[model samples]
Each structure stands twice: as structure tokens, then as C-alpha cells.
Target: MGALFDHLIAVPILLPLLAGALMVIVDDRRRPFKIAVNLVSTLTLLIVAITLLMIAGGMTASGDPARTSVYLLGNWPAPFAITLVLDRLSALMLVLTSVLAVAALIFSLARWHRAGPHFHTLFQFLLVGINGAFLTGDLFNLFVFFEVMLAASYGLVLHGSGTARVRAGLHYIAINLSASLLFLIGVALIYGVTGTLNMADLAARVGDASAENRVILEAGAAILGIAFLVKSGMWPLGFWLPTAYTAAAAPVAAIFAIMSKVGVYVVLRLSLLVFGPEAGDSAGFGAHWILVGGMVTIGFGMIGVLASQGLSRIAGYSVLVSSGTLLAVIGYGTAPVISGALYYLVSSTLTISAFFLLIELVERARDAGADVLAVTMEAFGEDEAEDAEEEVGVTIPFTLAVLGASFAGIALLLAGLPPLSGFLAKFAMIHGMFNPTGLGDGLPIGAGTWVLVALLIVSGLAALIAMTRSGISIFWASIERTVPSVRVIEVLPVLGLLGLCLAMTLQGGAVIRYMDETAASLSEPAGYIESVLTAERVARAPSGTPDPAQGADEETEVAP
Candidate 1:
């Protein structure tokens, strides 16, 4: 039973891969099979959630004061073979991924066919890649999963293949492909320096390396950082993001919200583990650069949001802003700050994805296909008198009204309003930044403090103004046309997502506590390395074989 549970680490990544393959063969004409796939995807998500709960419970029982799980593939030894590590951080990310997956799947139910053939297939594959990226412990494997996800996303981005979508998709592909190249180069360099790919082992080796090797390591790390930054839509590197995300179908864009976070996850993981405080602060390489980068990203995204006219584009830019804010929090490198960042990550994922979904509905109602200019023109025309009334005072479907209100709440929360998860998340992070604690020791406060305060004020104000403008355009501005009727199925998914956002806000405290624990676990990598390597060697030892023989072979190999 214990062995069975250990293997469960692979389930989150494997189930989606298997489901994706099966979806390709299942007759698309059969609605039953499609429903089955959705059910299975939901079940897979449940399984992941259960696995996280178990991991948390085990940590409680161990009395070891650390929460970590490691699964070696095919009973192979770590540092020599692949391993899947699930700590508080990875488990939390897994849960977040699964939550978003289930929500996106539900949202796509009615719109899947309309999205194009093999919609379910692409979606499942995307989930597979996402889960795999979160679980894998090898750097190269991470790149492989990233490519898989990117490939699936390319199809989803250009799913309908309109001119705007195709153009945006091309831009997206070109930029990401370049990032992939840089990723490969960086990984190759890191491997050359350390001769190991496992994250835990790399962290151990990086900590022990000489100053010269450390320089090489940091250089490679920077290159890898650039790749992730590009993926996360950091300023200047993320110019393609808004166009691409806006051009995607609504359900597809909802999934994309999860997609962008993968990069942020990687950066956070690497910064804390492979480049701990000792190494990072040695040459001013700690979280300072990340803080600066995050602030710039937030500023640029806010400007983009305020300036954009299209609802979808506005939502896209909002994603950038959220990503920036989360990154800034992570860059603070404090337990409280990181915890708050994790909470924000969850809140932002749900809220932003819901926002995109709502934007789609709003665009459809306005008869504007990612064209803000056209929608704005129609809003003022006398021919759209009925639509104007519907836009402002009309009776929307109950579900849609709920969803709209939910989106409004998310926007308000993101702008740092009180009584919301977003506000709480920011408060925790800021508290950690200004008033240093044990977890926050060694973090530079002089420059970082001023930057954090500036970011808070500027981002909050910008988000408030942009969100309000968008709300007026979407829900209040007069329309010279009749809006489309909201579909019943569509209403259900939107409302479900909205409910999730509200729930997160209501339970902010508990969630932040969990996030804090997760961040602390991530900061310490020794437990992970020892568990994986030790368990793997024991599991792989031949039945009835004496330990001395295995030890002799390893000793002989290392001696000369």
C-alpha cells in the first residue's frame, strides 16, 4: 500500500497524458466519449487533490519538521535516473494546476466543438505538460514538458485560424521558440558545469562549488532566468503575450492563465533552491534583479491595460500585471512574502481566468470578435438603443449575472481593495518586505523597500483605473445593437469559476498559511535530495542482494 501511494506521484502527470492519447482515438462524433473524457479529467484532478492532502498528512505524521515526497521512475537511483518530487511547493502547484484544469474543462464543454476538432485532445495534452512540468525534478525534463505544453498551446492559440489569431499565434511561436533555444543552451551549460540534472543534486553541488564554478553556474542560471522571464511575460520580453492571449478563444485563454504561471513557478523554484541566499547574495545575484524586473513588468502591463481598447486585450494585459505582482512577491524571498505570492497566484489564476471567460461572453454579446473599435462604435450608435439598455439595465441570465459580479469582484480584489484575497495577499507580502523577519533576513531593504512601495501604489491605481474603464465599456456603455443571448452551459462554467474566486477570498488566511509552509519547504533542498536518492537506491537493489556488494561497486567506481 505504501509503495502504491509512492507511485501516485506519477498519476497527475500520467493520467492526462493517457487521456489525451485516448481522446485522439475516441470518435469525436460520440458525445458520450467526450463526456467521459471530461469526467476522467475531473477525476484526475480529484486524484491530484487527494494526493496533495495525503502528502500534507504524511508530513504531519513524520514529525521530521519537513514536508517532502520523492518518486523515482522504474525503481532507479536518483542523480542517475529521473525522479518526481512533490513537496509543499510542488504539491501546492499541482493542486492549483488541477483546479484550473477542471474549471477550464467545464468551461469548454459547450464550446469545445466550436473551438475546432480535437479540442479535448489538445486540452488534455496541455494539462499533461503542465502537470509534468510541475512534478519532474530534472531540468531537461522540465524543458521537454515545456515544449509539449507550448506545442499544444500553439494549436489552441490558432484553433479557429482567423487572421488575427493566426498572426498572433505566429508571433507567439516565434518568440517562444527563441526562448526554447535559450532554455536548451542554458540547461546544457548547467549540465556541463555540474554533471548532474536532478534539481536536488544540483542544489547540493551548487552550494559546494568553488567560486569560479559558481560564476559559471550563475551565468547559466541567468540565461535560464531569461527564458522563464520571457515565458512569464516580463516587460520587454512579453510584447507578444497580449496579442496572442487576446486572440485565443475564451476557454483557451482561460487555460492560458495557468500556462503563464509555469514560468513563474520555475523561476521561483530555481531561485530558492539551486541559488539559495548564500550564492545569490555573494555577487548581488540574489532576488534584487527579480524585484526590479517584476516592477518593470507591472508598470508596463498596467500601461498596456489602460491603453488597450479591446476587452480581451485588456484582460490579457491584466494577466501580465498579475504575473508581475506575483513575481515581485516571490522576489522578496521572505517566507511571508512567498506565502502571500502563492496565495495571490491562486487568487489571480482563478480570477484572471474567469475574467477572460467573462470577456468572451461580453465580446460575444457585443458582436465584437476581439475588435474593441467596432464594439465602441456600436455602443454610441442610435441603432444600438436596445443593446445599450441591455448593456446597462437589461436582465441577463442569472448565471451570467453571477459570473459578471464575480469578475467585478476579482477586478476589485486585484486592485487591492479590502475584504478580498488579493488585498490580503498584498498585505502579507508588503509586511514581509518592510518589516524583515527570520525568513526575510539578508534581503536588501533600502532599495527593495522603496521599489515595493512604489509598485504597490502604482499597480493598484493602474489596475483600478483600467478595470473601471473596462467595466464601464463592457457593462455600462450604451450599445447600438442587440447583444447575443447567453448560453445555459456557458453560464454554468462562468458561475462555477466565479464561486471559486469568492471562496479563495473567504478562506485567505488558511490558504496563506499553507503557502507559507510550502515556501519554507522549498527553501531547503537537502530533505528532497536525501529522500529521492536514498529511497531510489533501496528500491532498486536486487532482491536478496547484500548491501556490501552494491557498496563495493560504488566504492570501486569512485576510487580511481
Candidate 2:
């Protein structure tokens, strides 16, 4: 029974792969069938993700609370074959990806799915890449998954076939293609230096390299890190993000939120595992650069938030803000800080995704170019005061009211206001920064720490102001605009995402505990290395012998 559960880790990747292939064969005219296939596959992925997470976090009897699970392909040994690793961090990311995918897929079914022929197929393939990237334990396979993910996203971005989407998609594609090239070069160099591309093997061998080899290894890792940081939407490299995200379909944009985090995740995982304290001379390499880069990115993202006019652009910049915060805390090199950052990561992701969907619905009520006209009027003083009429009460329509309420909720979450998960996440992060070592350790809070805290507060303030202005423009000043015919299908996904945020708030204690445990395991890499390097292949019975576990006349392998 336990042995059967061990294979669940592979299902997240394989199910999507097979489902996508099936989707490709189905006739494009049969939209309903394709949607059903995609829906079932995604929901199943979600269940599998949650179950894997339980196993990773040791919530079940079959799982070990302190161990990492490594699955070798073809029952091959480590450093010689492809591998998939399931630990607290990877499992958490899988769950996150699945949840966002389900929401985005359902949202697409409303109308976005009809904009292109292969929408369902591309969506499933995107999941294949994302889940594979999270689960794969080898550098080469990571690159493979990244390309698969990017290729599918390129199609999704161009799904609607508009001039804006085309232009933005081209630019996005060009930038990522260059990043992919860099990724391959780095992988090649790392393999050349270490004779292995497996992450666990690299971690075990990196510190033992000769002096010249260590320099090459470090260079390769730096090149690799650049590829990830670009994807992470760091300031300079991320110049294309706002335009690309603003032009994407709302559902596409919502899912793209997680795309940036893929870079952040790799950076986080590799930074700790490959260059951690155990890595002799390379211990803590590049920490300062990541720290400084993150601070600058935060300030840049905050400024972009303040300067942007459109809601989609604001949401795009918010992604940068979230990434910057996570990067800074990860570079801070403390377990407690990372724990808080993990919580913040999840909260911000949910908030940004919900905000994206809400933006599409809200904009439906206004005429095109309304935002530009409003800005122009505000700037040129073209507005004339109306005569004071009899004071009359105005009743808001139900759809508009729901939108306003959802918008307000998103605002609270983004601004880190009280009674929601956002505030708790930020508070926890700040608290961690203040007490770096723990309470009463008497360590002085560094100047850098203060800067991060201030940035967090100011960024939240910026978000509040921007969202408030946008909401008023859409809902209040434009009262004469026709109420959009928002379907229940569209609105429910938005509300469902917000409800998840609220649930996070209500269950804050348990969530924080899980994050804390994840952080602890991440900070200590010894266990992860031991598990991956020492994982054993299943022992097989003699040929033609019926194994008791199989209860049939066939050879069976048993895990001992």
C-alpha cells in the first residue's frame, strides 16, 4: 500500500502530458469535450498535489516528517539517471501551481477558450512544463521543462490574436529565448566542471572541486542565476513584463503570475542547496548581489505601481514587488525570515491572481479608453462642475456591488491591511527581520533590515492608493456606463480565489506552522542530500516467481 503511494509524485507530470496529447487529437470543433478533458485533468492534478504535499510535510503515516522522497526513472541510481524529488518546498509549489491552474482554466472556459483553436491543449501542456519543472531533480530536465512551459505560454499569450497581444508576445518570446540560451550554456558549463548535471550530485561535489574548476563552476552558476533572475522579473531584465502582462488575456495574465516565481523558486532552491554553509569557499556566494538587486527591484516595482495608469499594469508591477520581497528575504540568510517570506509569497500570489480576474470584470462595465479619458480630463482641467441638484440616493447594481466588494477585498490584501492574510504575512516577515536570531538574542537590527521594512510599508501604501483610484474611476465616476453582463462562471472564480485568501487568514496559525517547518527543512540541506544520494531501487524477485505483494505469476519489485 505504501509502495503504491510512492509513485504519486510522478503522476503530476505524466497525467498532464498524456491529457495534453489526447487534447491535441480531439477535434477543435468539439470544444465542450476538450474543456471537460482539461477540467478533469486539472482537478485531478490538484488532488494529487495536495496529497503529495501531505506526504512531503509528513501528515500521513506513510511519510517521514524529516525525510525527502526521491524517485528514480527506470529504477536507476542517483547521479546516473533522471530523478524527481518531493520535499516540503517542491510539494508546496506543486499545490500552488495546481490551484492557480484550476482557477485560470475555469475562468478561460467562459469566453477566452474560444479565442484560439488550441487553447485547451496549450493550457494542458503548460501544466506539463510547470509541474515537471517543480518535480524534476536534474538541471538538464529543468531546462527542458522551462522550454516546454515557455512554448505553451507563447501560444497562450497570442491566443486572442490582437495587435497588442502580438507585439507583446513577440517581445516576451524574444527575451525568454535569449534566457533559454543562457540556461543551456550554464547547464553545459556546470556539467563540464562537475561531470554531473543532477542537482543533488552537484551539491555534494561542488565544494570538492579543484580551484580552477570551482571558478568555472561559480561562473556557470552565475550564468544560470541570471536566466532565473530575468524570469523572476528583476528590475532591468523585467522591462518587458508590464507590457506583456497588460496585453495578455485576463486568464493568461492570472496564470502568468506564477511564471515569475519559477525563477525565484530555482534561485531559492539552488542558493541554499548548492552554495550553502556546507559549500566551503563558495558558501554564501552572490548573497550580497541578490540582496541589493532585490531592494532595487522593490523600489522600482513600487515606483512602477505609482506611475502606471491601467489596472493590468499595476497588477504586473505587483508581481515584481512580490518577487523582490521574496528574493530579499531569501538572501537575508535566516530560516525565520524565509518562513515569513514563504507565507508572504502564497498570500501575495493569491491576491495578485484574484486582482487580475477582478480587473477584467470591472473593465467590462466601462468603455474602451475610459482610463485614458479620465486621466486626460484630470490633467487638462476639462471637467466642469455640475449645478447642485436635489440630493438623490443612488442604488448600486448587484454585479457592480459585487465587483466593488471584491475590489475592496483585493485592495485590503494588497495593502496588507488587518484581518486578512496579507497583513499577517507582512507582520510576520517584519517580525522575523527584527528578531533575526530569535527573541532576546540581542542582535542589532541592521540598516538593510530597516530599509526592507520601509519598502514593504511604502509598497503597500502605493498599492492602496492605486487600487483606490482605479476602483473609483470604474465604479463611481462612471455610473452612467452600462453594467456588464458578467456571467456566474466568471465571477465565481474571482470570488473563489478571494475566499482562499480569507481562509488563509482564518487558518493563519496552521499555515504559518507549515511554512515554518518548510523553512527549517530548506535551511538544512544535509537531509535532502542524504535522501537523494542514498535512495535505493526496488529489489526484484527471481524470474517467474509470483511475489506476495503482486499476488500474480509475474515478477514484482518490492521496496525494502
Candidate 3:
């Protein structure tokens, strides 16, 4: 069982790749078969992810102190071969990705899949990239995974084929191309200076770099960060995000809520592991920049949320806000804060994704002409009189009622209202910020801490106002609009996502404890470096027979 679980670590990447390849060979006319394949593969991935998460958290019988599994490709040693690492953080991301993939896949069955050719193939390939990026142990593989993800996303973004989608796709392509160029250049410079691209090896050697190489290294890191920040939807670099997200198909948009976090994840991982306090002179490098940039991003997102008329745009800006909050908390550089940020990360991602999926349903409930006229009137400052008809009792259909309740729930979550995971997440973060070391210690609160606190409060308020206004316009003011015909398939995914948020709220203690442990591991990365650098290749049996000393089923397990 342990051996089987060990091999399953690689399944998140391999299963998707195989499924996508098979899907490509199957003709597009046979989409039902392809969909079935995709669904099965995704479900398998979800199970694997949960198992790996348990293993990483030490909930399993694998009593490895490090709680890290390093899978060396082609049975080669680390720092020389490609490797995939399974640890607390990577496992967490895999679970999140798989859950979202399942929800999005189910939602797409409602018709979004027919909007494009090779939708299933692209979707599976996208998962491959995302899963690979999360698990890879080296820098070059990260780049490879990043490109695969981006290439698939380009197709997904343009899936529904409209003028808006085409326009947004082009801009999205051009900007990401530039970012990719930056990524390559940064990798090259870092490798030239450090002579290593394996993340673990780089961390081991970075602190010992000469003064001259250190400057070049920092420059490379900064350039690389710019690329990540662009993906993270940071202020200046993310102007394309709203339009592109708004144009994407509903399932695509829903999954993309995590796409932005890919940058945040990389930044967080590298910053703590590579440039940590152990990096000597380079300790805390670029952290202040990240802090300030994140705050600025939050301010920008707040404004965008307030200014956005369409719910899709509001959701897009909400992504930026979530990213900024995580970045800021990461820059604060405390284990406690990171734990809370991780909690917030999961909460906001689920809420935002649910919001994106729900938007499509809500928009369906309204008349297209009515939507256009509402925007037009608001834009031209035309004040319309309210209907003065006497109050008449109206029966809300079960569909609209469910959708409205979901919308309200999403709004409350996004706005950090009480009794929801979103509120708890924010509260946890603020609590951590105030007590950076611990509540028992006496420490002066810094100005940056106060600034971050203020921004969190203000952003929540902004989200509340925007969501309320949009809800009223869609549900209340548009009384004459028809109730959208919705299938159970579509509604289930949205409910599933929101239900997860509620689950988080109920399981807050366990979640926070897990995050705390993950954060502690991240803070002290020596264990990660050691686990990767010292990982062993599996021993081969001679003469096509297993050695008596080694169990036949356990040959693939990492050597003790």
C-alpha cells in the first residue's frame, strides 16, 4: 500500500498527460467518450491528491520525519535529473487544483465544452501543467510546466469565440509572451551565476556565492519576480486581466481563479526557500518591494471592484485582491502570518471560483437587452424612476431562490462577513499580523502591519458594496426579467464549491493546524533541501529477479 501510494505521487501529472493524449487521438465528434475519460482521470486525480495530502501532513503511516517524497525521473539522482516533490505545500496545491478541476469539468458539461474544438484535450493538458508546476523540484521544469499551462490557457481563453474573446486573447498572448521571455532570461542569468537550476541545490549554494555573482543573482531573481508578479495580476502588469477574465467561458474563468495564484505560489515558495534568513547577505532580499507592490495591488483591486459594472469584472478584480493579500502576508515573513494567509488563500480561492461560476447563472436570469440598458443608463447618468406599483406578493422560483442565496453567500464570503470561512480567514490573518511572534511576546507593531490591516478592512468593504449593488441590480431592480432555465448539472458544481467553503468554516481548527505545520516547514527549508539533495534512486534487481532483501512491491520506494 505504501509503495502504491509512493508511485501515485507522480499520477497527478502523468494521468492527465496520458488522458489528454488519448483524447487527442479520439475524434472531436466523440466528445462524450472524451468527456468520460477526462472525468475519470480527474476523479482519480482527486483521490490521489487527497492521499498525498494525508501523507504530507503525517496523517498516514509514513513516519518519515521530513514528510517529503522526492520522485527522481528515470531513476536518476537529484540535482542531475528531473524530479517531482510531494510535500505539505505541493500536496495542498494539488488538492486545490483537482477539486477546482472537478467542479469546472462538471460545470462545462452544461455546454461550454461544445464552444470549442479540443476543449477536453486542452483542459486535461492544462491540468498537467498546473500539477507539474506545483510538484516540480527544479527551475527548468517549472518553466516547462508554466509554458504548457499558458499554451492550454490561450486556447481555453479563446474557447467561446466572440469579438471580445478574440481581442482579449491577443492582448493576453502578447503580454504572457513577454513574461515568458523574461522568465527565460532570468533563468539563464541565475544558472550562469549559480551553475545550478535545481531549486534545492540552488538554495544550498546561494548563501556561499561570491559578491559579484550575488549581484547578478539578485538581478536575475528580480527579473524573474517581475514575470511572476505579472501573472499574479499585480497593479501595472495586470491591466489585461479583467478584460480577459470577463471574456472567458464560465468554467474557464472559474478555473482561472487559481491561475493567478500560480504566481503567488512560486513567489512564496522561492522567496522562503531560496532567499530565506539563511541566505546571509541576501536574507530578506526583495521582500520590501513585494510588500509595497502587494499593498498597491490591493488598492488597485479595491478601486477596480468598485468601478466594475459587470459581475465578471468584479470577480476578476477580486482575484487581484486575493493575490495582493497573500503576497502582502507572504512579504511580512512570519510563520503565523503565512499560516493564516494559507487559510485565506484556500477560502478566497473557493469563494471567488464559486462566484465566477455563479455569475453565469445569475446573468442567465436577466434579459440581455435589460442588461445592456442598465449599463447604458448608468453610464450616461440617466436616472430612471422606480415602479410605484402596490406591493404584490411574488413567489420566487426554486432556481432563482437557490441562485440568489448562493450569490448572497458568495458576497458574504468575499466581503469577509462573519460565520463564513472568508471572515475567519481574514480574521486569522489580522490576528497573525498583530501577533507576529506570538500573543505572549511583547512586540511593537510596525507601520506596514497597520497598513496591511487597514487595506484588508477597506478591501472587504469595497467588495461588499460592489456585490450588493450588482445583486440588487440583477435580483431586485430587474424584476421583469425571466428566471433562467438551469440544469442540475450546472448548479451542482457551484453548490459544491460553496459547500467546501462552509466545510472550511466548520473545520477551521484542523485547517489552521495544517496550515501552521506547512508554514513551519516552509520557514525552515533546510529539511526540504536535505530531502531533495539526498534522495536516492531506486535499486534495480539483477537477472530479472527481485533481491531477497528488497520486497518485490517496494523496489520503487525511496531507500532509507
Models, CA RMSD each: 3.7, 4.5, 4.3
lDDT of 1: 0.75
Candidate of highest lDDT: 3
For model 2, the stretches where C-alpha displacement exceeds 4 angstroms are: 59-66, 380-391, 439-444, 541-560
> What is the per-residue lDDT of model 2 for residues 1-560, given as tens digits with 9 covering 90 to 100?
17877788899999999999998998999999999999999999999999998888875455447478899886667756589999999999999999999989888888999988899999989998988998899899999999999999999988897899999999999999999999999998998888888888888888888899889999999999999999998878888888898899999998888889899999999998999878989988888789888888999999999888888889999999999988888788787788888999889998898888888888876777888877776678653446224224667889989988999999999999999999999999898888787521222588998998999999999999988888777887663467888989899989998999999999999999999888888878899888887887778568897534343223222121
Candidate 1 ranges with C-alpha deviation above 4 Å: 62-66, 278-286, 369-400, 438-444, 481-483, 536-560
- Per-residue lDDT tens digits of candidate 1, residues 63-140? 755446777665556665578887777777777777766766776776654557777788888887888898899898
- Per-residue error (Å), model 3, residue 363: 0.7
lDDT of each: 0.75, 0.87, 0.89
> Which residue pairs in model 2 clash with each other?
none
Off by over 4 Å in 3: 59-66, 369-389, 439-444, 540-560
Model 2 has a clash total of: 0
Better TM-score candidate (1, 2): 2
Give the winner by TM-score: 2 or 3.
2
lDDT per residue (tens digit) for residues 388-431 in model 3: 44335667789989999999999999999999999999998899
